[model samples]
Target chain A: MSEQYVEEGDRRREIIEAALRVFSERGFGGATIKEIAREAGIRSPALIYWYFKDKRALFQEVLGAKVPVVRAVADLARVMDLPPEEALTKLGRAYFAFERMDARVLRLVIGEAIRRPEVAEAFVRAGPGRVLEFLKRYLERQIELGRLRPHDVRSGARMFVGMLIPQLAGKLFFPAMVEDGLTDEEHLRNAVETFLRGLAPES
Target chain B: MSEQYVEEGDRRREIIEAALRVFSERGFGGATIKEIAREAGIRSPALIYWYFKDKRALFQEVLGAKVPVVRAVADLARVMDLPPEEALTKLGRAYFAFERMDARVLRLVIGEAIRRPEVAEAFVRAGPGRVLEFLKRYLERQIELGRLRPHDVRSGARMFVGMLIPQLAGKLFFPAMVEDGLTDEEHLRNAVETFLRGLAPES
Candidate 1:
C-alpha cells in the first residue's frame, strides 16, 4: 500500500481506539465525538468526520473492532470443512476464550445495549447478528453435506450459541455463583456433545 | 391476619413497588431512599428502613419480586415428580413468559449489574443463582429416578439454562434480527429437545 493510504489507516485505528475508551466510560448516548477526538489527540474534532459518517457509524466501528465474535465469524471459512462436532468445539472454545479476554468491554457494551435501543441495534448488527447469520449458513452447508440433520437452521444456530453464552455471562457477571463448577474445557465439551447429539442425523 | 399486620404487609409491598420505579430510572447507585419514599408517598424516608435494611437489600427484593425465575424455582416442588422433559418444558415455558412481561425491569437490573459488582451478586443470588441451584437439584433427582442420564448435574443445569437465556436475550435486545424467524414455541421446543437428547440415558 502507498504511504498516504497506510497513514490514513493508522489514523482510523487510533480514532477507533479512542472511541472505544470514551464509549466504555460514558456509554452510547452519553459519549461525545469531541471528547473522542481529544482522547485520540486529533488536532481538530471535525477530522473524525473525514473517517466516519457520524457518531452512530463511529460507534458501530468501535463495536466491530472490539467484539471478537465479529472476527470469529469472519474466520469461519477456515474451519468450514471440519465436521460439525470438531468445528463447533473449535468455534465455541475460541468464542469463550476471546469473550473472557474482552469481558470488561463486552460488559460495558451489553450494559449500554440494555438501556439504549440504538446501541442494542448496533451491537446485534455488528456482533451476534453477523455470527448468527454465519452460523445458520454453516448449519445449512453441513446438512447439505449429510453430516447433520435438516432442521430450522435459524433456531439450530441459536441453540448452539445459546449453549455457550449463559456460561460466559454467568462467569463474567456472577463470579460468586460460578464457584468451581465444570472447568471451561468440560463445559465446552459437554455443550458441543449435547448439541451434536441433539442434531445427530436419524438412522 | 390482624389489621396492624395487614397494614405492615401492604406498606412493605408499596415500598418495594416504589423502589422498583426509582431503581429503574436511576440504577442501583443513583437511586436514593429519599427518592424512593417520595415515589412511595411516604412522609418519612426512614420508613423504607423498616421495610428493607438498605438500598442493596431493597434492590434484591425488587429483583426477587420482578424475576419470574425466582418464583418458578421456589415452586419447583410442585413439578419435581414429573419426568425430566415434562418438568423442564413447564419450567422453561413459565420462565420465558414471565421474562417477556418483566423485560423492561430485568433489562434495567442487568444493565446495572454490569456496572456494579454488588448488584451483580444480588441479581444472581435473587434470580439465576437460585434457579440454577434448584435446577441442579431437580436434575439430580431425575437422574436418580433413571429418567435422565447421570452426569455433572451442575453443568447439566447450566446447559439447559444456557439454551433458554440467549433466545430470550436475543429477542429482548435485537428485535430487528429476530424478525419472523422461529416462533417462541419452536425455539423453546428445539432448545428443550436438544438438551434432553444430549442427556438421554445410554441404551
Candidate 2:
C-alpha cells in the first residue's frame, strides 16, 4: 500500500510540473486542461482531476510548492553564529541562485498575481511578509550589535529584495538585455556583489 | 483644410487615450479594437482606421508617446551646472512622480513591452539605455569628484534604478503595500531619501 501511495505521489508531481510549463507559456486564462494533460503524457484530463480536485487546486499546489525556497532563506537568518554581513551575503546569493534557476516560475507567479488577488495574498503570506519579518529581526540584531546603521529594517529589507528583481526578471522576460556569452550564473553573482556593496556597513 | 486637420488630430488623441485604458485593463491580446472605439466615443470602428492604420499602429503610437518623459530625464544629466548627487536625486524624483501621476500609462507600456520585442526595443532605446548612459556619466563625475566610492559606474546606475522600480510599480499594482495615511508627495519624498542614503559614499 505504501509503495502504491509513493507511485501516486510521483504521478501527481509530474502532472503539476507539466501544468506549470503550460501555465507559464499561456497564462491561467489562456491555458486549458486538455493542453496540460497532453503535456503530461496523460491520455485523459480526468487523470489530473484524480490528482487535483480542479485546475485552481492544481495551480494553488504549484504556488504552494515555492514556499520552501523562501522559508529556507528565512531560516538561514537564525543561524546566530555567522557575522551579520556574511549571513546577508549568503542569503542574497542563495536568493539570486534560486531566481536564476526558476526565473519562469517567478515570472508566472508575478504575472498571475497581478490579476488574481488570491494568488498575491498566498504569495505575500508565504514569501514577502514572512521574509520581511525574518530580515527585520536580523537587521534589528545587527543594529543592537552596532554593526549596521539605524534605519527602518522593514524598508531596508524591501529595498534589498527590490534591487535583485529587475535584473533577474529582465533576464527571464528579456534575454536580449543580457549581452551575448554571459551566463545567468555570472550575471547573478555580479548582481549579488553590487547589492551587498550597497548594503554593507560603512567602515 | 487646417480646421479639418485639427479635428482629425483631436480624434486621434481620443483613440490613443481609449486604447491606453483598454490595454491597461484587459491586456494586449484581450483588448479589442471595437471596445477601444466604443470607449473613444466613436460611432463606427472605421473611424479608428481614419486615424490609425490598424490596432497595431495605434498600439505603437501609445508606446511611442512615452518617449518624451525619457528624453526629459536624459536631458537632466546634460545640464552641466547641477552637482551629480543633486541631479540624480531630481531625476529619481521626476521619474517616480511621473510614474505616480501616469501609473496606467506606465503599466500599459511595461505590460506590452513584456510580450512585444518592438515595444521592449522602443523602451530600451527611449528609457533604460538613455537613463543608464546618463547615470554612468554622472557616477563617473561623482567618482572623479571624490564624492562616491571608486566602482563601475554602470553597476552603480543599474542598482539605483533597479531599487526604485518595485515600490513605484507596487504603488500602481499593489497600493496596500504603501503605508496608510501617507500622501503621495510624502511617500515619494521618503522613497527618494531612502534611495539617496543607499547611494551615500562609503566612509
Candidate 3:
C-alpha cells in the first residue's frame, strides 16, 4: 500500500471523529463545515469538501459512525450465567463507560433532537432505544430463571437508565453542576447496586 | 387604579412568561430579544426593551420566577413523621411535577449551561442544586433515625434525581424520541417506587 493512501485513510478517520464531536457539541444548524474542518485541524475546507459534500453529509457520516457504540451496548447483553445482579452491574458499567467515552454524542442528540427531526429517531435507534430493548430482554431472562425479581420491564429499564443518567450524562456533559468527585467506576457501582436493590424480589 | 397600570403589569408578566418558554426552547445564544417579543405577541421589540434592558435581564428574571418549584421540593422534605421512603416518594413526585410543569426551563438550562457558564451555577442554585442539598439533609436525618439504608448522601441523592430525569427531561424536550405511552402520573409512581425500593434498609 502507498504511504499517501495510509495517510489519507488516517485523515478521513480523524475528520469523522472531529466532526462527531463538533456536531454533537453544536447541532447541525450551529455547526458549520468550516468549524468542523477547524475542529479536525485541517486548514483547508476544500480538503473536507473532497470527503463530504456538505455539512448534512458530514453529520450523517458522524451519526453513522456512532453505530458501533450502540452495538457495544447490545454486546454487553450477551453473556454466560453470571448472577443477575452481577450481570446487571457489569452491563451498567459498560453502558456508563460507553457513554462517558463519548459524552458529547448523547447530549448532542438529546439537545438537537427538536431542531433536527431525523437525528432523534436515528440516535435512539442507534443508542438508548437499543440499550433499553436489550436491558428488557436481559431482565426477562433473569425473571424466567427466578434469579431476579419480576417487574414492569419497560418502566424498570427506564429506572435503570435513570440511575445511570446523573453521572454519565449530567456529570460528563455538565461537570460544574455535578459535585460528586467519584470516578466513573464508583458512580456506576453505586447506581447499579441501587437499581438491583430496587428490582430485588421481596425476600 | 389606572387601566394602563393594570395592562402594563400584565404585559410585563406576559413578557417574562413568554421569555421563559422561549429561553427554554432555545438556549441563551439561540434566543433573540426579537423572538421573545414575538413570543409574547408584542409587535415591537421596543415594548420589550421598555420592560427590560436586554435578553440577559429577561432570562435572569425568568430564573428568579422559578423559585417556587425549588421550594416545592424543599417543602416535601419538611413534612413531619413520614417514613424515609414515603418522604422521598412524596418529594420525588413533587420534583417530577415541578419539572413537568415547566419542562422547557429544564431543557433550556441543561443545554445552554454548556455554553453559558453562569447560567449553570445560577440555575442549579435555584433549581436542582437546592433540591439536592435539601434532599441530602433529609436523607441524613432519615439515616440517623435508622429508617433508611446507610449510603453516601451525595450518591443517594444523585440516584434519586437520576430516576427522575428520563421522563421529566427527555419526553418534553424530545417528544419524538421517547415513545413511552405512560402518563405523567404513571411514570412518577414507577420512579418514586423504584427510588424508595432502592433506598429500603436491609430487611
Clashing pairs for model 1 are none
Q: Looking at model 2, how many pairs of residues clash?
A: 0
A23-106: candidate 1 lDDT, tens digit per residue: 877777778999999998886788899999998889777766766666667776787878988888877876676554367667
Candidate 3 chain B lowest-lDDT run of ten: B169-178
> lDDT score, residue A191, model 3?
77
lDDT of 3 by residue, A1-203 (tens): 54245487788888999888787677656787888889888877888998888766676566555644354454553553567667667666666555442556655566666445566565555566766777777777777877668777767777777777666654655564477576667767777777777777767
Task: Give the interface RMSD values of the models in order.
Answer: 1.5, 4.0, 2.3
* TM-score list, all predictions: 0.88, 0.68, 0.72
For model 1, the stretches where C-alpha displacement exceeds 4 angstroms are: A1-9, A32-38, A44-61, A99-101, B1-9, B33-38, B41-58, B99-101
Global lDDT of each candidate: 0.79, 0.61, 0.68
Index of the highest-lDDT prediction = 1
Error at B35, model 3, angstroms: 11
Candidate 3's displacement at residue A158, Å, is 1.0
Superposed Cα deviation of residue A49, candidate 1 (Å): 5.0
lDDT of 2 at A106: 58
Which scores greater on TM-score, model 1 or model 2? 1
Model 3 spans > 4 angstroms off: A1-71, A98-101, B1-71, B74-77, B98-101
